[model samples]
Target: MAKRRREHLFIETDGQVYLVRDRGTLRFPRKGEELAFPTRAGGTMDFGDDVVRRLKPVLDHHPEEWYQRDALFDRDDVDGLVKRAIYNTMIRCVSEVVVSKGNRVLMVKATRGFSKGHWNLPGGFMDYGEGPEEGVLREAEEETGVRVVLDGPLNVYVSGFPGKPAYSLGFLFRGHATSEEFRPKADEIERVDWFTVDKALTLTRNPFAKWGLVDFFLQSPEARRALRVRRHGLWDGATRAVRPTVFLDRDGVINRGRKGYVRTPDAFEFLPGAIEGMRILQDAGWRLVLVTNQDMMGWKLVPDRQLHRIHEAMLATLRKEGVRLAEIYYCPHHVLSDCACRKPRPGMMLAAARDLGVDPRQAWMVGDKVLDLEFGRAFGCRVAWVGPKEWRDRFAKEAAEWHPDVVADGLLEAARAIAGRPEGPARGRGAGRGAGRARRRGTARS
Candidate 1:
């Protein structure tokens, strides 16, 4: 049998190793040759003691003529190979802290590194000898200038991307800041501020940090409660407070309702006048929010990431037309499950009220289904049932039973009626007398 090829490096008298390419062969550098190695950043740096130590094991087993360090450090694949080597040899540990004050989480905007300009938790790679908890505290202080007193470990997450050579074992901790004051390291962090749990979730783009935040919100009752309260910032006192929000149902009300599910972005198509109706409501000083039932997630009919992509496409389209939603809340439970967030349960509405600081009693809920009307009524919202007259007639018993304030053919008519504009002609019952009767009877009854 042929002997296995051995890869090694030549060591000098002073314990430094110099590699050079000569005549298409890799060999030890001549006495007066430059001492440096190509860096992944397209520059050269000293081939220091660290590299020497890493290569020592290979040196111990291989013969002098078997030097193959240059093969491992080939210019074309050096970065990936080095990363793979490190990843295979040892575990890369990272630590992050979720620091909270009241119902707000502290977040930092990265000024450098891969997450530049993105909001992230105050954390980083753990030091060589530091414990995960100690490393997290140190990182928190370094990034936000606040010493965090840890409550406990929130979770341990293993994260990596497919086809990527690097991965990390991340430790997340729940903690509280010593003070509100922050002096962010200017070189690494651009800004340090507190955000409500919902806002923080939207702002943080790093998956690891987002997962940690999600875990913190799920595990901490205090954090969950904070999500409902209005977040008041330093400048909020001088500004007009929260606006009345209009809770919209997603499928039939905004986009064309699908049979099974929307499932993908390509399958999502907006109904005519939907964007115009939303824009009208937004311009009329109403905060637009979406409350939807996405039970396909619970049933495993669609993955969470696919749903996210669909929403992203929808939001991007709305942005193109100058409309924006304040927040989106969806119930991801199966219809058979008794979950609080499902339609007709009032959970999503209550959470929306808390997060957006709007009273549901003064808000409007426009949707096409009986459950949507019931959901709005459950939360004391003025409900508008949007559908053709035939559809309303088919569910006439439910219509009279729920007593929706406005019955419109589509979202545009509903918006007009809600905004106190003439809705052309009465569709089923106008908001004038119907709303008066509905309000007098109280939405809570039947």
Candidate 2:
């Protein structure tokens, strides 16, 4: 007769029911966690909220039933979507915006300014589980060097902006701060001060203002509460959790390697079918990242500028070949360097994911070397290896190291494997999870 813990909550937006599982902790099949068939199905899933309701009935039949949600429950697709919506609703996404006021409010600092001198309230990306009030307050204090208290309602706009496929969906708040406690976080703020609302409007070189901040704030109530976060279930809340963007590792997967270090631009080289493979994945809508380890800089084997030039050549070649990359993140440190940006460490890729708003779990990593594969797997990506079979056999000794979801010859074949298409014969390399390095490049520039 114990009460079932409630791990899920309901959020309703636009009259649609969305399920959110506040619990993200019922840890089991995390990214990179070994895949295993269920021996017994009974276990707790950390879905948010206080009560753990009976597992959704449909889930017993279809484990992936957590994906469909959002539609009139009366519709044919209603049930599954409802369940996913509910499951997703158990989680939440929150961001921040700051409203700095002096004797009178003037200009608001822009978080990411569009036009030159166009300013708005300063705020930043929120970490997981941080509340909106806490987020805004923290940002206000960090940006203005002032500690403020949230005094009102959360204003949200579900609208789109230019260059965006969807909307610049965001939330905002009004707050009060003391001049004594106000000091901007250095390097983030150019200057923090007060100006007349009219002076701000006129002095700013940029003309685009959704309307002056004062005029906008005047229209909304600071103290009045608005509609709370609406809840949806598995079927209704599904859209919020889109298939994630991927972060890829470069070097081994993109081109033949340079022994010792591909120190100069001339040393940079691409493997066969590499560019085409990248284009295929890009066209299929996957964000490609280049996570590389270049310890030569610490060893003075390569200068930072030389490395940049090499990357420039690499990118130009890709651009000419019609390959578009979301970004290329490199780690210039050695394992002993202890710098947070190196691989086998996950700092660089992790940082890139944070900046690009990508989910590591939804990401994929491919490489030829053991450390690269190990690093990617540890960082939450589904991993793949390219190269030889004996290499995998050698890898078996460290089988506890990393796991590859699939193995193929080179980049082209690997891309096919990710798309769920069986790979053709790997011309220069062998296949399987514990395979050899595909298109291995020497550490020396020949």
Candidate 3:
């Protein structure tokens, strides 16, 4: 009879049973070497010479179990084993770190494995009994020889290959390097270098790594300042006690409107020319602030953290295009809740005025819906209606009543017209005493 394949060897030591897997064959750890025994929960425990000493006694007690002949497999048993093997799945934990110094970020070129010859963040598969944070720190040191001091977690990314049952869950972290010098691991890393955020984004080949860089760009103060310099040059140090501001609506105006809601980052997509329009406004020295109604939160359709993740990705994309928002405010009340901050109420605008120290009268409110127009009118700001002609025709009576100062094809056209006007408040339908009275009445009611 052919010998049965011995997949694992059992070792008993100190009243404990340990398993040593050797890929369908039994092998003992050599002197000064340690063997890893994987636990039932997918973690591993290491055992060395102490366990090795008891191997002989365990083999002596279970000689038949260890050296048993290959059992004849019936068709039903073989089929069950094949089915289980085919359907079994496993999730691997991976951790990566984005190490930064001033305006530069650290990245490594890989010499081996799947990402060979491409640049990637310094990280690897997590080890036994290590959490993501601890694993990332170890990986950073192992690959780049840099001790990273973690600032915080950035995001989690999941990846799986087609036709594969295993998936990898990656934990990304942001950190600052403790030392400038790098000693790249010779076996896995080709070299390490620091790069500007823009350059690093171009060099990174892994999608998950790129997402981490995007999050870093959004959260890093130094990176944001560097981006500002690249976009607008050095701030001339001119002080403006009251800068002109633009209050924007989020869903329909900034991103494509969704039927249900933008519950995930994957569902959020920028409308055509939206980023360019925002860039134009920013370049013209306008402080962009987002004011939106997010009733999804009130309805328990989306969690606050999930919504924040969506915005993080949104802001990161905008920053990539050289546009930065001064602030974002959203009403987390149900549509039927009569919340003061909801559109058509002046609560959000009032808060914006006090927080940003900008006059609502001098600001321009741009949105696609009629509630947005009414909100701007109530706040005593010039309003621009953004949509196609069909939409305008559909809401002709509301448009006529609201009398938006500008009705354009979209935000790009509206922004161009608004930016061309002279510095001071443009002569529009909604400004001065009547609008102020309207604002006062709205504030009083709220």
Lowest lDDT block of 10, candidate 3: 437-446
Q: TM-scores of the models, in the given order? A: 0.43, 0.42, 0.42
| For model 2, the run of ten residues with the poorest summed lDDT | 223-232
Residue-wise C-alpha lDDT for candidate 3, range 1-446, written one tens digit per residue: 85433222234333333332345533333334454432221212223212212232323243333221122122232222222322233366888888888878899999998789988888878886799998988888988886789998887776665333346777888888888788888899998999866566556656557556655665677765554211111122332234578889998888998989999999999989888888777777677888888889889999878878888889889888889887777887788965557777655665555444445435889999998988776665678999888988899788777788888888899889888876434334222323322222111000
Residue 198 lDDT (model 3) = 56
Rank by lDDT, highest first. 1, 3, 2
- Decoy 3 TM-score against native: 0.42
Model-by-model lDDT, in order? 0.67, 0.50, 0.66
Taking the tens digit of each residue's C-alpha lDDT, what string does model 2 give over 182-299?
5655556656666433334333332112122322233334311110111111122111221234455666667667667677888778888888877776665565667777778768
C-alpha RMSD for every candidate:
22.6, 18.9, 23.0
- Cα lDDT of model 1 by residue, 1-446, tens digit: 85543232333222233345566654543333443432121111123322211322223332443334434554452333233343343457888888887767889999898689888888888988899988888889989886779999877766653333335777888888888788898899999988765556556645567556655665567766644322112122222223467889999889998888899899999999999999878766677878888989889999777877888889889999999887778877789976657777666765654444544434789999998987776565578999878988899897777788889999989887887733222333322322322222111100
Model 3: which residue pairs collide? none
Shift in Å, residue 219, candidate 1? 20
After best superposition, candidate 2 residue 407: deviation in angstroms? 1.5
Instruction: List candidate 3 stretches off by more than 4 Å.
Output: 1-241, 423-446
Give the runs in model 1 whose Cα sits over 4 Å from its true position: 1-241, 421-446
